[model samples]
Target: MSTSPQKRKADDLDIELDLDEYVPYVPIKQRREAKFQKLASQRNIPEPQKENEPDDETEELVRAGPKANISLIDQAVEVKKQKLIEDSSKTDIEKKLEEEKAIMEAVAQRKLLASVQELAKGIIYTEPMKTTWRPPRHIRERAQADHDAIRQRYHILVEGEDTPPPIKHFRDMKFPSAILKYLKYKGIHRPTPIQVQGLPVVLAGRDMIGIAFTGSGKTLAFSLPLVMFALEEECKFPLIRGEGPIGMIVCPSRELARQTYEGISSMIDFLVRDGYPKLRHLLCIGGISMSDQQNVLSEGIHIVVATPGRLMDMLEKKKFNLDLCKYLCLDEADRMIDMGFEDDVRNIMSYFTSQRQTLLYSATMPKKIQDFARSALVKPVIVNVGRAGAANLDVIQEVEYVKQEAKIVYLLECLQKTPPPVLIFAENKNDVDDIHEYLLVKGVEAVAIHGGKSQEEREFAIRAFKEYKKDVLVASDVASKGLDFPDIQHVINYDMPKEIENYVHRIGRTGRSGKTGVATTFINMNCSEQILLDLKHLLREAKQRVPPVLEALEDPTEKFKDLSGGCMFCGGLGHRISECPKLDAQRRQQLGNISRGGGGAERGGGEY
Candidate 1:
């Protein structure tokens, strides 16, 4: 075998190959695994374990390692378990929040469905509105002159398309016998100008914008028709519990609401006693128990007389719904809007699911209110009696330049000028209280009323004054707007109101119900020149003597004649829109709101 070198090399290679085959050879993977095990063992590191294995097993594995002091794997497993628990808790919290949100959404949807169902039921009882009532052709032709004469005699100015002719007497409307008798008992022998025209439009079921002087029977004009409408509905389909309020009257003040409530209640009582179906009405105003109002609503209501604030609150709270309400009257609507109830009014209207008969009665018709009326009413009849914002012709307005300090003393003398049953209007509640106390101390039986008084207190004071138990009623503007005191002989302005419109309303309190009365206004240097200038123009327009102080004041209206022809918005002669304090304040408010990241500033701007 060792003879040749090449042959020997070949034989050696063959032998080596055979040896390799026979030898117990380790694979590369096995070799690496062994090497890693050796390295881990030397370093005191434990082998990796499966996630599904028990923590005890992992700890055992770590402990089994030679020279291993602590189990890092066990610590890691414990940390993972804590993280899992934290993750589960977070998931549960999120799930709870989502469930709550879903529940709220479901509740809201259910309420909406319930409202819709109720509205459907309401619509079932609704009757088609009659917008016109024309007499027979022969009668219309024959009585045309008679109608014209009636309108002229009452100073009735009507505007609208296809408006019904004015009715001369209550019987012409063909009211229920009970209502006729009640009116007669109340000494309402004839319809006033507003009643003459307003009755026809309302009975025809047409929307109306009624403008008349204060105490001109506007309340009766609207209330009587409302009662009739409600009665017809009740007779046709009686209301179940929580089913009604077919008619609603919204006033601006609590006193006004109470008055309207009493007025309607009197008529309703008369009708009920005469064997008509019972018609339930509610008086909803602040300073009264909400539970009491809710209780009334639960039984079912046919009519509701309320102020904007409380009415809006009740509607929002779902105490009662306006689904069945078809007739709506807004008494002293301008005052309501002026007192910041416009938004509330609009919100309340949103609850009406169907078209309604809307009546807006006011002593004044500013352009702003006119625009609102246009948007709110559909094809409404506008009945204007005399000039808007004009002083009552029957009022003897006496303007005096009384110093501020002397006003209190002068008030006593003014009281002596007129007999008992005098109304004194002051701008501030504090002033009203002071004047009332002063008059009482001077042996004058006086009572005070303001927004600050409780509902009971205000009612008592108004009642005492109306009954002539109190000689004078010292009140803030709350009593001036639409409160009716039957025989108020005099109205004394303790202080001139900042706005001329208020002055007009203040004087309007006395000269009411076709009776002559006197209004004494006290102005001083503290009074605004703009108001003074407005007073001057109003005096001249009314044919009253204008004091030299007011007459001498420059009329800024001439400067604005080229721009706007005067302050058309508020009917002021001393200012344009540029100088309008109301507009300026509104703009400032809008800007402030915008700066605070509020939207809809443009909406407010467009209102101007």
Candidate 2:
């Protein structure tokens, strides 16, 4: 709307009032004109007056400058050159990666040097472990050569893709520092064949079936990996009793379970240092208070070393759960089957998750064990340290053909031959008690253990034997397998074992850890004929001297041959019919008759 001059002045005054907080309202064209006017005034230059031209249609717009001629390719090339110059400089990320690599290499060198120093000081077993970070050609070649030698020596047979090389020494493996220290403290320098081979597979997170001799350190092989796995899991998730153990080791016998628990617990204790968490382990076995075990479970355990029956009992009672279990190890799996723990093991396995790792270790791989492995393990690698059913080669076996009644006498003779620390294995508890009592009466220090004995008594007997307080430990098949007695110089088989595997395990009680030992068996007709052929084959394979009595049993017809043929009355083998007990009795009667006739003739006739 048109306004008077006075009204426009009033509007301008209103617009100029308090412009500090005012939002700009003037349009761009008017602002630019005012800016030009202010600039001309500041520079004291005359303003270019707008020309008073009539509104004509023909008005020309003027250009400020001319455009330069340029091609797209040259412009792109120039831009690329600048980009290359910028890229030639190192970025912050690249610098950081280089620093990290150097730091890692330095750490590796320090670790290697520490290992070598320990070896030099006779702390750890063997030399420093070869480093894979910057492996030299010579180092790799030497490692390969050592691995081949170990394989050849142990007769190791492996079946798996990407099977790691066997460890020659404990240091060759990447165990936690706690384990190495424990080994050093225990004077275990070299890794046994089973430990060397089986540990790598288990540590690599693969299911494995390990076959090795009884005393070949299979326990530690599985235990070490189990500790590492539990530690790794504990770091990821907090342990709770309701979730059960992250790792579980099932053994056949209570002794084996306790032994395994002790081994694992010692290492776990060592692992609980400044920066590491405390690892809790429980031994769930029979003959112990169930309430006590329940208390342990309530507190929570990272690992559970259990016997099949006891583990099943715990499961049934809802004492623990296995749905979150990550590792399942069956030590002496074949023995477990023989002990009839297959059903319990399977039932316990049902509680575990399907994604668990399984490890089955046995001295001998029987058909039952093989079947179980096929069902339980997922593409397991079989690691055979030696031939199945083969006895320890270091035992010097000698058989004596004695009557079953004379076993005690023969045992005394064996004691005379060897020094202290003798293990006497009998067939039954009665025989063990009898022998133990006889030895005690003979002023010989002895102890006895059988399945019938209370657990406390058995443990006491074992302790006595281990401490050298008792020179002789008479036992049944209960101590035949998985008991480690390092100082046993002789194993006397007072009563031959019924099973061939039991016989092997009985003799295996000696000649452990590459030490030479003597095993003497007293054979009678009852057991000799039955086990003669098997014994002969075993002795021959072990490079032992087979007695002629056993060698004679090689004939298939001799399976029923009686080796104890002798006189039934006098128990003598070389006697004629005329000299038998019946003939002697008749002769004595005739002599009596003659004596009586002489006496009557002298008394009645007086002169004859």
Candidate 3:
């Protein structure tokens, strides 16, 4: 054991090393010693040298390898071998990353042209959508019956796909079948309209603009594609972790950001259940503690869900890095801009390279949003489920002029029979509160949500409204754009919106899910002619009937419901004279005949 030259030959070569491909900081002299150590380790040299030997192998693995400074030729040759081994590992990491970058290059470049090229893809409801010409009652029923049959047949025959183009390079990807099996188990055997179309373009690293109404599966559309890329590349991110952005998903509000995070978590759970277990993500939003989010980042995370302001705040604090990001998504893009987040968006995006894939989605895109999109996202695929003019065309439009004083009674009248769950919009916080209180006192299930509410309260209100604990949600404009209430069957403009665009958001809440919705605006007598003019213009743009009567009413006031008058029978304010105890019996007796529709009454129920 003392020293057989033959026995010592292999021991002389064993070494240990670990390397990263991107770092070029490793020096040259000690590289030979690394080679010898690697050779010895590979040959399993025994512990004759192990007793007092330092654990240099474990200590030096992440940094410069053993023999990093050794200059002797014999050790250098061993070190050279170690360096080669380290370099090879680095080379493998580099080669794999390069192939990913290369494979993704075409996708990245396509993003350069995606916006214009993808604008026309999902044109499901164009002029033809408007060609129904208000089918007659019988014809409508018959048409609906026919369509229902077709839809049911289609649902059964196909898994709601549009001949999904097979994934390119499917064999090259090392997908965990258990994940696929899990999806299959859940009958998610096929992707939805948005997913089937958006995934390929995203996987190719192209930017996309997703436009679909609520519940059309927009969340899964982008999330699945993101997962696909992360899994295929085994994306490096530190969660609770390391430094650098692997991905960022920006939503308009904390509510939406949290929703997206929860969804991604479930997807990860699903994948894990099927045998492919390792998946990591993060959630960042306005109300959450920055330190908590930063700690998660310290560990490194693969996916992050955040709103623009909070994400930017974290970015400024150096809690997250966007320079290394390969993917970026903007959910409810239009709403984000409306919330005055343009500056923050550009600031957060500035940290990302131009080569990153950017996916932006909204229910509707205005010119303002489009202009911002111009500077924000690269040429992105615009997957519009419906365009500006055609948005919510499936929804029906209605308007009713009511006296300011009679509004409550009229609302109660409207609600008396067959009341539908409604979204009532008001111009101010005061209005939201007043209207909300009235509804609650009237025994209607209702909740109020606005900027004044705490984040927790706001979230609770939203959940309560969604779960039907409340059938109506009285809110200010804050609830308009970012919300998606697919079951809202009616939207009432409790107060005529000051801006016409606000009216659009108000009514857009209803008539979701391709269901015909009813929106009634209580055009008060006080609304200015210009306000009326604006309403007309917007209605024209939306291509719906603007009530010939509303146009005809001058200084424009004809109350739709005449519920505010004195009790006509008795001529008592807010009550019938017969019901008023203040009246003398003789007076009551004298007016009794007239009040009861026996003497002074006119025909057709318009008597006084």
Candidate 4:
């Protein structure tokens, strides 16, 4: 008998099992028994004597001795069998478990769909079309006259030395043909409208805040000009052989930094071939082993794309020189603030010299962000792609007043009707997990991403979502930031956010660049008056169609309370674990009553 005890597992290594799609073969036990019996029969050497067989040592020895051969047969298994055993020692079995679990998930998804379909048939009603009275010819003429007069007032195109010349062609900028060639290889020969308008302004060393929807090739909009500016500076300072990193791009999230780097990798690679071999790009984000990052930084870099917090930590540790950085791009301007990185961003900005060219881009610009931009940039050449009182006309906004209990029903309907690769945003961490489970149960392919997950888990989830291994992506605010997932065609807000700012960021995930898309939100009793008001304010700002019913719940008070827990009703979360009501209540009760109770409260009462 073996006396050795099994090794324990580490707690942080989240182990999960999935038995979905489990095409199980017969147990190894069956094989063991069959092989043992076959060997016994072969070794028996039957004696064909009549009557009763004599009880002899031969028979006794035969049974026991034959069993010894079974061990040898076990060794005859394939190399793959041995490899699986060996590999198990290095990796946790949780990954395989997850795969198996997916089979169950598929079943659950189907059930969810069926139930949702039934509910959808009842709740989804056709909205009646509004009939408006026709306008008179005089009214139409008056409107045209007013439009012309407003255009004339704003059309006073003053000729100033600071104003950049209108762009005619990409070649006019004179970027190295090698870089241009690389851009062409990536099928990005044409610069975006923002790139055409923003590049010239950025290249002029002017600060700029460009508001454009997602997927408009904003990375190139900021990067191409920054690269050109740096290249020009290098030519002027030829004597200084090795100047440290000249440009830095600060994003709000790791995924964004990663995507941004990929977006500009070929262009940077082309620079390396042009003999400015010192041209090196660095990436810094959470969840990565920092040893290699530190080692690479010791030698220095020409460009660094990083999330704000990690970048701040690297700076405090003096990882590299930042005094020379002359270019900065806040790639996801709105997300940085929404992700609570505004402070980190401001701190990073302080490190760079005021002369650095600053560029900020976001789908929506709020007052807080405007204030930040005003302070951060010089008299910036503000380029607004946004129309007055219009919020991404390309995106269709929808809201559903779903019953609190009928969310699952509504969710199923949305999933079935929505196009594939839809992004579903939840307000809390648990909701991400729960919805991910529900979708899997309903037979819809899906995955979840949150801070609770490790780096590897997050990467795998995104890959599955992007590669169509999954149809829906269930995520918390973690997905709301600078991250980019190109295949996402629809965005569903399962829960409304507390801040109007957050709502803007959430919707911005879709209709990126110039692509048309749709955003749908859940509004019900769970949606508080404050949330409703915030939505109305946003709608008014965007000049969207607002129903008369929306005006009924005019929130008289600002209610961003930073509640102790996510509202159990809506699942909206914005606070830390310590602040949770359930946890707090448990702690309070535990502290109030001693485990021993009054049985030990004898002599001195409660006084010590």
Candidate 5:
């Protein structure tokens, strides 16, 4: 070690440093406490500690209170234990009484729910109620005489027990001031024949089947009542989100639905402006966004005018419910069945949770269809203004024999017979387009609508024609059913419809709202003899001039003397029940369906 300074330093540095033998540094106080604990444990003696010494964290928690440390699990456990102890302490009789009390509460709750449901469903009568209020005997007799005179004057035929007397004017309807004002604004001073009777029956909440000529205020007859009913319902209990349609109107075509929706909307708008509660309505039909309809449904609705197909689709998807629906209208019911929508209508009805006031309106109502409609109603009143399937007396029908090739050329000359607002109806879509194009080429302002066109196009065309922007509106049969075209001076049948009921509907487009109109029909050899015979009889019945071509045809009623006026099944004078083309077609369709393992065909019962 004393040899040299360098040798000494080298010897000190050369000593091996083992990493495994290394230890982390510790404070002196902690090391001493650990050493004392280890020594006490080895000697089997307890180590002394300061009494009542609280750590900082523990002290803070104690200051916070006992609740601070209790976990949710512990609290739940405590509650459960307390409940169990209370339950165990109960006597057998007491437990039985508690159980009985729970059952009674449940029963009471169920009964309350049922009553609420009944209130929401509104009221529908099962049968017509007799008039309880009476005037003096002489006054009653005079009133009866007056009613009979009115009925006879209007050709009003009513079939029901204890039917209400028809009102003489709109003022007799007892409508709200706003409604009366609306009617006055629309230039309606008096009620039409259908409205005279229909208003009373519908306002009374009786089920009814109304058969009147087209364009005879049938829409108002049903729509006004629906408005009143919906108003009453909304006043009683306002519709919540996703709830609605206290009243519904089902049409066979989209155009009709839209028209109805717009009409109701106008009335509603007027009422709302007059300080009435808002009544929301929706138009449910094809060629519209389902999302838009769903959005409207989410906001709730009070009334809905819809076509069968779209309505069925919405019902199937559970977009909205008819739980609150108590008023239903089937406009053009015969046409609906003819279009094979009877099943859809029935299916829609199935969605209703309770009985509803059902109304069936049409220009024609065959007996079979009436019976079928009656099955769904509870003692419905049959109100017929004039004979079923009878042409509108307001319409002057003109029949001409035109060659198929020359019909297009004859159309221009016919349009000249009427003013700017003329309706030309073709049986098919292509013919409508051809007519439209031809008129346009001849520098005539014309618009055309058919099922083949988009909804936007059809609406635009209808709007243009209605506003008098277009002088002529060439359309297919789609425009015939339940479409109210105002000021239509003339209706030209470019092609005769296959069915006579359709012919009546087509002509009905012109003669509307107590206004006289001219209907010019073109018939060629392509038309069936059955239609010709029916047309001849319809012409004769309406006291119109009969074309020589149709007049030359032998009247089938002559051969079947026992068959009385017309085919009782279809109201067609051309054929008896045994020879009815409609029946024969239905039978053939039925056979074909059976052979194909499908359901039977549902045919329209001829015009009412």
Candidate 6:
């Protein structure tokens, strides 16, 4: 087939093919073979084969070639054998048998070598190594205690008639063997608290609102249910494009949508290999060709992970239908609401049946999110892993009351001190770009991402940052939420965010997956008062040291000593201005001058 541009040109040129003649149309394969043979003949590569070679000609050649030379007959025989070996008519079973024989031979040779080594070492036999080790009784007891403490600490509220029990281990749950194998392959032995608690609620097909910190495995908590549901349907019926997708994941941003897609896609491949129905998924985001997305939708998909805007676009374009969607997940719902995607999300949800199982996952649940959940979900089990606005306990927060002009200096000092892979978040795109350029000028490997950047540039920046090709990533709030970036050692707030919740999200970028990380914020009195108060409270909750300025801002009464009159010079408000010693020397000098001037300029020394 011609390329699209070529086809368009042909259409514009009014080209037509005439099929009236009896000229036999040649297959593309035969035409290409003929063309290549002509080229080979030109190059004198054994003169090309003729199209109409008589069968009797080969017999005549065999009878006469022996008279010419005996080696020619041997050559012909060898060529015939090679042609037979290369024949396309070979059965798949024959190929499989050959591969199996080769593999068995290799295994036997390895075994023989190992046995020879054992004999040379004078060893009679060897026992297999133990690959599994159970935790000691004390360790289990401690872990149980910790789990109980965690459950007690977090305000995990559930309202359901029959809630499934929390799983102690992934193996204890009745997940498919494929999922279990994937877990083992990923070396995820222990489940996070959110997973332990939320998995059962979701697997039971209950509407759930899971509030967990970033990188706490909430993706898996919700994704596993979608995957399991798809798997269950796979055993019952074949899922085709005509049926639309079985699961739909909506995230606020394209990066987050891609992250969720990747998380679910990994399991899809494994499940398909483990005898499940072939699963197909598509990422629906803007900043790409709509025609390409429409093409994919025409082919059908089993799962659609998309940002809200692009999904709405596709829905309006009639690219795909959601009638068959059984699982609906809204990841980072709070962020979606914050980014003003609530209407889009609501509109998209309207396309699906109200009976579809809904799962909303967010890091924090403000009143807006709570109301959104109530309106969209049905009796969702509100699972709060920690305090709603609390920063991750794994992050060590440091605050400095730096002047606005000196922020860059402080940032540079921090970059010099901290390890690589630092993330610097700014409040706006201009700041992000400025910091990125400044870092580059200073020879720091830095990349930037923001709404101002093109989609390709943003993707490249994200990729570079993730791969450590760039050590520092300067970004606006776009990178602060939902995106799963790993091994970020430090997060520096070059400019304090306007919202307290955003502060939590920015620092939450680091200190993820139970890893300890550092977050440094350059704050000044010029920052918003509400953010200052919120930062103080958050720092106190996280058990970090609060600066005196922040503490004073948090509680003005405690820092207040006296509000009475003070020395005008020092402005201490601790002494009267008249008795202030700062004026004594000036008064003495004035009196001496007046005396020397014969009292003509005698000063009124009452207040002097």
- lDDT of every model, 2 decimals: 0.78, 0.70, 0.58, 0.61, 0.79, 0.69
Please provide, for model 4 over 1-608, each residue's C-alpha lDDT reduced to its tens digit, 9 standing for 90 to 100: 64433322332222322344456788886777677678868998443222366566644444345553335455456446877887777533354344434533442221111113333453322221111212234433555456335324433121123444434346655566877777777767666656665665676666777765555666787877666655655565631323457788887666677777776676767777876544456787888877866645666566788877778887888777677887778876755543235445656765654256667887655433455455555566666554311345566787777776778668888876557989999888888898888888878888898777887898798878878888888887777765666656689999887554457667777777557777888887777565576576556555677656676664432243323222221112332222223234434554555564722112110000
Write down the TM-score of every candidate: 0.75, 0.67, 0.56, 0.60, 0.75, 0.65
lDDT of 5 by residue, 1-608 (tens): 25798887777666635445668899997888899899989997445443587576664454444555777676678779989999999875466457545533442221111123343564443564232233234433566778778888888998887677777776656677888888898888899899888888888777899999988899999998888878877787888898988889998888888898888988898888888889988888888876766666887889999888778778888888998888889899876644355656666777878768888999988765676566667777899998788899999999999999999999989988977799999988888889999999999999999888998899899999889899999998888888998798899999888778888889999878989999999999999898898888889889999988987997756744544546655677676555567756756777888899977554332110
Worst 10 residues of 4 by lDDT: 599-608
Winner by lDDT between candidate 4 and candidate 3: 4
Query: Where is model 6 more than 4 Å wrong at Cα?
Result: 1-150, 153-160, 290-296, 554-608
Q: What's the CA RMSD of model 3 in angstroms?
A: 30.6
Backbone clashes (count) for model 6: 1
Ranking by lDDT: 5, 1, 2, 6, 4, 3
Return the top candidate by TM-score: 5
Task: Compose the digit string of candidate 1's lDDT tens values, residues 1-608.
Answer: 35798888999999999988895879997787788789879997655554566687677656655545667786678779988887787754355445545533442231111124344465332333663344445435656677778789889988877777887777768787899889998989989999988988898888889998877989999999899888888888999888879989998788888899999989998899889998889988888886766666778899999988778787888878888998889888776554245556666777888778888899877765665566567677899998777778889889999999999998888888878789999999899989988988899899999877888999899999888888889998888878888788899988888777778888998878899999999999998777777778778777999888887787756633444324545666566544555555655876787899975343220110
Query: Worst ten-residue run, lDDT, model 6?
Result: 599-608
Clashing pairs in 5: 364-608, 365-608, 388-608
| Range of the 10 consecutive residues with the lowest summed lDDT in candidate 5 | 107-116
- Of 4 and 5, the candidate ranking higher by TM-score: 5
Distance from true location, Cα of 432 in model 5, Å = 1.4
Higher-ranked by TM-score: 1 or 3: 1
lDDT for 369 (candidate 2): 43
**Models ranked on TM-score:** 5, 1, 2, 6, 4, 3
